[model samples]
Target: MPDTKPALSKVSVMQDLLKVVAPYRWRIAAAVVLLISAKISTVLVPLLLKRIIDALSQPQTLKALPIYLLAGYALLRFSSTLFNELRDLVFSRVTQRTVANYAQMTFEHLHLLGARFHAKRRMGGLLPDIDRGTAGIAFLLGVGLFTLVPTLIEIALVLGIITSRYQAWYAGFIMLTFLVYTGFTVVFTARRTIHQRRVNRLDSSAKSRLADSLINYDTVKYFTNETVEAQRFEEIMRHWTEAAVANQKALFTLHVGQSAIIACGVAAVMLQAGSDVMAGRMTVGDLVLINAYVLQVCLPLNALGFVYREARDAWVNAERLFDILHERPEMEESRGMPALSPGRGEVVFEHVSFSYEPSRPILRDVSFRIAPGATLAVVGGSGSGKSTLARLLLKLYAPAEGRILVDGQDIARVSATSVRSMIGVVPQDTVLFNDTIGYNIAYGRVGASQEETVGAAKAAHIHELITTLPGQYDTEVGERGVTLSGGERQRIAVARAVLKNPPILIFDEATSALDSASEHAIQQELNRLSHNRTVLMIAHRLSTVVDADEIIVLEQGRVIERGSHEELLGKHGAYARLWQLQQREDMDQRAAASRA
Candidate 1:
């Protein structure tokens, strides 16, 4: 589980971030050198001012000094600006690449994970972690590399210069006072402030969830739980507001304390420099020099605060980023799986026992076989393991015990991709992405052209529908095929399967959602498409599969009866009961339509 605690300080977080920047070590080295040059220029202005003052004290060296110093100062500022821009350019590339790599790596890991992992994971929880990880990259670049480390360098150089030229007293006064101010503020305020930070993350997550909810408002309205959902969202927002305010209060206190310390430090440094000037040891320009040094030191010091804030957040993100980069996919490909011979479409389920849970078996001693170029329909009520059998066959879920054979070869031994390509699936859910109708149809076979796509659509009886749309085959399906009716989507799925032209076809309720007229049309397509192909199918409606070569009735994960429709009714088992029920329902529907 990811820690929900708001990263309170950057001091600890930044140490490890420096390691990730190791790959582009040379670029970072160049960036560091430029930063050092910039800092040296920044620190030198005070020394130049001191020299200008010393020269002015002697009438002999006065004339040339002012012009020389002014020119040098202008040159230093220009160089600093150039170096600063270069440093930023280098840093931006490094950050961009790191963030892109991390996001892609994480996305890949999430997708590779099994269905079980996603089933328990909340979309909100996973999404925020990704956002937090990406957002942390900005913080790492700004604080970890740029602000924090540069501040340390600035403080070390400033104190060294001040003590060597003047007295240890000057460096001591500045460092001691700065430390005291920082220490007191952090001790009193950090606990409350960090709590607020966590609150803000959750609040941000809540807003993302709310936006998703609004986009899915149609589903919310259809379920008629608008008031219940509104209240739930409102409650989340309220929690977020409380946490946001707490964070604000903590930051406000820290800033107010920091500002007061800055004022005191400025006054004290000036007072000391003023006394030196009055004593004839320092001149007006020397005072200017000391003031410049004080200001330079303070800039890095304030930057340290910003560094601490951002670094805290970045470290949390690093943990998430690393988690993804290090993940290994389960079920590694076997070393010696030979290429499968052209499939004869003969499948055998040999006493295959499988379950999602250790305690409960979804399929127990289930055994069946379909001969080459044969059609077999499996009929079962909900939770009777019909779909689990299909999944086991597809190698989506491997059987716990026993084995399945394809074309006289163990399925586990053959290449999973090769096995899958030999069998095309028109699944229960006809999923279509937001793409053109032509592309969606052509997805079954790569590089399929307009002619091929339309041919498949014509076979599925959807070619007329495609031509009626504004863009014809170019029309977008919208999200999950929402632009078309369920029957239309089903036809498109069937069309894709037809295009695949696999040796074996598995239709899991392919025509279940279609109206009678649409189903009748697609039924002809299925018959034509299934010719010379081994068809293993599952269907809810009896009328569609009544003509199958064999109909197997499954109950409680066991095949209780197997025969043709007439033969099953004569046997008067589970298949007979299902057949009678469906017949009664069809008769009632026809009778009601006639009366109306």
Candidate 2:
């Protein structure tokens, strides 16, 4: 029942990373060259130091302070730093670009995904996953490449030099130490990874709870359940804290173990060097050189353990992101699919059946037709599949057992974009972006001019109301347009559909939130707008659909009655019952108003 897909393997994650980095291969190569230069300079610095020590130790060679050698030592040290800085500078663009590329790809893909996928996703947890995923890419590129690879190269160079110039025992001791240190790190870090994963999961859960609580702040306040929400959020955070502590304990163990191994290795190597010097088999300069090489190798080995651990964490984060990329979209848009041809808006559904799940069917054997420039109204109680019909027409979901046609063409044969472009919908629950009113209106048709947006607002009968506000069209609609009243949000939805001016229109309880006067005015505008366009009206108010060219009464996803409003009333079926009940309710409301 969980929405998340399985995490990708480390190999797959790396393969995806390489594909993104392939475009910057030349830059990466340049960075690698700089890396080698830096390491070479680094290795030569200690050699120069050994020479300085040998020269200083011998009475005959102490003259002139070995100025050239001292100068070379300083220059090599500076050159090492200089090359490392230059490598980072050259490769910085590649890391940043790769992050941006993946972020944009994920963002665009989220929009292309179906409503079903989005309905199941929690925005709170989803955002953190994306943030961590992109950050992981940056770490793997910057630290993993520079630290891991350079450390290995330096190790190889140090081992090679020590084996050629010193006793075989020195090189052998360091190699054995490296193997043990690496083996220890791998085993401990693997165990720590399990803890790290748990920490990440709990962290996401806590954030999800926080966001869910804040988003429903009004609901909590209404029910006086602030304490309940706090308790729930605290519970999740408590688990996160526990997991984080466990992860830290594992990290401490790994670090302490690594330090112990390196300390023993260094002590052993230094003891051997001292014995060799005392026995006359090596000079004081050889002792210093051997000491310098051992420390050099051990320091990076320590850092190598840390880098390897972080890389594993990075791999986990990247795997979660790549899993999202691997998810198959509910509907695939094939390449070179034909666009729906422009024509009179004639819509038809043939034996269409659909279900969100096999056990719960939403629509069944539904068939209907809307003639060009005519309106067909569908009436039903709650859960009768009236909205599903509109969803099917908009190509939001594919029909399970039948096909829908627009302008005599099967919609499945055309690109979804084309099908959607030809129709406009006003949903019952209108949720607007947290933006200026003009922006929300213009979203109906991207890049619409100010004049066009204002005109559409006027058509929806909300222009005067907007002008009364301080900011007018520029007024901010807060999150989900919560700043506005329900009727106001409905008007904006109607304005958006009006702005689109598509060949086909679907009004799913479009005027349900408006007052009677506003509803009557908007209803007239909607009728005018529906002229010369196919319209599917899904309504609960019997009064609004009385003038529909034809009416279909749906009960449990089946059309039980079909005819003109008057004809249905004459039949005294479900439609008649609904009309009579609404009439009585209207009369009672009027009587109550008079009494008041």
The predictions' CA RMSDs to the true structure, in order, are: 3.9, 2.4
Alpha-carbon lDDT of model 2: 0.90
lDDT top scorer: 2
lDDT over C-alpha atoms for residue 528 of model 2: 80
What are the lDDT scores of the predictions, listed in order? 0.78, 0.90
What does the lDDT read for residue 184 in candidate 1? 58
Candidate 2 structure quality by residue, lDDT tens digits, 1-596 = 34233333556667888999999999999999999999999998888899988888896856577899999999999999999999999999999999999999999989888878888998888898899989988998999889999899999999999899988899888998999999999999999999988988887788888899899989999999999998988888888889999999999999999999998889899999999999999888888888888888898898899889998898777766777877778987889999999888999999999998889998899999999989999999999999989888888889999899999999999988999999988887899999999999999999999999999999888899999999999999999999998778877887898899999999898888778977887788788888888999999999999999999999888999999999999999999999999999999999999999
Q: Report the C-alpha lDDT of model 1 over 194-292, residue by residue, as the tens digit.
A: 665577567556866676687687899999988987888888888888887877787777777777787788788889889998997777876887788
- Model 2: residues with Cα > 4 Å off, grouped in runs: 1-8
What TM-score does prediction 1 earn? 0.88
Which pairs clash (backbone N, Cα, C closer than 3 Å) in model 2? none
Clashes of 2: 0
What is the Å distance of residue 548 in model 1 from its true position? 3.2
